[model samples]
Target: MAVEVAATRRRFTRAEYYRMAEAGILGEDDRVELIRGEIVEMSPIGRRHRAFVGNLNQLLVVRLAGRAIVWVQNPVALTDDTEPQPDLAVLRRRPVPYKEREAWAEDVLLLIEVADSSLAYDRSTKLRLYAEAGIPEYWVVDCVAETVEVHRDPGPEGYRDVSRVAGTATLALQAFPDVELTTAEIFA
Candidate 1:
């Protein structure tokens, strides 16, 4: 069988994404986000993905507890994209604190996505969106490849520095000093 597909792309903004969310176009359980104005559905999490994010969350809690916010699976509002949730986020400390509350883009110091099946989208789409918004740092926990790609140096365009860390290799944080993680631990 043969089929045809359009080459054009969808355009949207953070406001529009919020509207959709408010109108119930996206449900609470829907694992989707507006990336570069296009709605992208995230793959259903399996054991591996959940475990990785969970482990990272624990590590962040221990190291960045009072210093930094160990935020997990929360939406970060960005331009051209509304609240795209990342797996784990090490957020900058707030004045009053919102630990039990949800996190927004302004609260984020580092945004991380644990990618097993959606690696390309995380790399191409979310990375660009994060950089364009001047996100300080971004990390991709590559489960399939067993590596962590650290992204930093956010400018108007995108990140300027990117490095991949393998097993037993520690990846450091820019804003959160003394906090480091190894690939093995993240995947463990």
Candidate 2:
């Protein structure tokens, strides 16, 4: 005769995740983000990832000045169970700083994720999450493939439109048609 045992897993809400951070249960050094009620560890930023993010930030800041706010590696609240810190978020201009409150999907014009090792996760899970949250535009910069995947027209099933660009091809946003950059400029 043998005895049987059952194992269960507990899922957390966004509020609980914040409480853990406030209580010092989660430290500032912890590279983690909440996704669908699960705390997922973020990949360490490599030199390539850092450099690309910096370059994009500089370009975006110069181009989008006064038109929108460029947020770097900051969390954007998606839902009660999901908060993802995208590499770059172009937010609608607001009078108050985001420090007063977290940026929500409604406030975003475009979201960019510079992906090297985390390309798959960014394309799949993160993509679905963003689409479900109704984020208008999402871009995944694939360092491995040296291509940029653009997603737009978010729907419940996922993004209705998806495109890829690389090399000298230029990328533009539907929200900011004036802002355009070539793939070379992005991955440079």
lDDT of 2 by residue, 165-188 (tens): 977898887788989877787778
lDDT of 1: 0.81
TM-score per prediction, in order, is 0.84, 0.93
Looking at model 1, residue 10 earns an lDDT score of 71
Give the best candidate by TM-score.
2
Q: Give the TM-score of candidate 1.
A: 0.84
| Per-residue error (Å), model 1, residue 88 | 1.0
Off by over 4 Å in 1: 1-12, 96-104
